[model samples]
Target: MGQRTFAEWLERDMINAYIMSPDSALSPLFLVERQKLESMLLGEQIKNIITCEEVDRKERHEKLEKWIRRLEMTGFEKVPLSYNGRIEATNLLQRYSHKYKFKEEHDCLLVCWSDRPLFSVSAWKFRR
Candidate 1:
């Protein structure tokens, strides 16, 4: 995705969003993991947005739908993510922070940071 598209996602909800703030109550290992992840994402933002690149203003949802349609054209069918797997993912996130959320919709697991969806995890299989 272009930097503009990526920035729109951040601008839409990430502003002032404290989705990954480290908590003193958490274990030191978890805190370190969170810091590392934050650093990686920040580095990406610096590379993509801070470098003064052209920004594509296309709607992100439209782009995502276009990709899904392309995948369908390639004979890939959306498969429901397993319930047990979703449960496991939920449990794991809950162990870290309740700020993260998972919503099951349209056979995909939507992972949200706070109220906005960060990304989705879905299974796909080729139709024989």
Candidate 2:
């Protein structure tokens, strides 16, 4: 099978197998991770399966919150409560608060990490 076809099959198998024996196959941490991943996947699937714009908006917001929490817990400092918008992320850097900057450019939030930017967050993208 093609790579995309195999990936689809694998994702389906992961969900099906987890459903069939969640307790047996998944450790507590793995279960939590799986739940997060499943929530993200199911939200995307909902966007594809249903056409309601409201549902899509809610799902996207929920997903963004999930990601933000995940990032914070992984040591990405949370910006001050007074700050908002895309630049808020860069504003959270304690040491580089003055030099490092972020801007909304090219339809994306650009974070400039200078040579001396604070590197507080771990390299790992996800936590167990």
TM-score of each: 0.56, 0.22
Off by over 4 Å in 2: 1-24, 52-128
Candidate 2 yields a Cα-based lDDT of 0.47
Q: Write the per-residue lDDT of candidate 2 for residues 1-128, one digit (tens) a residue.
A: 54566656655654554343322344889877877777577645544433447544553323334656666687764432223543456557545445465543322343444442212322233333
lDDT of each: 0.65, 0.47
For candidate 1, lDDT tens digit of each residue in 25-123? 778798778766765665444444433444642223323466678779999998877779888999999888888898765666778766777677878
Candidate 1: worst-modelled 10 consecutive residues by lDDT: 54-63
Worst 10 residues of 2 by lDDT: 116-125
TM value for model 1: 0.56
Q: TM-score for model 2?
A: 0.22
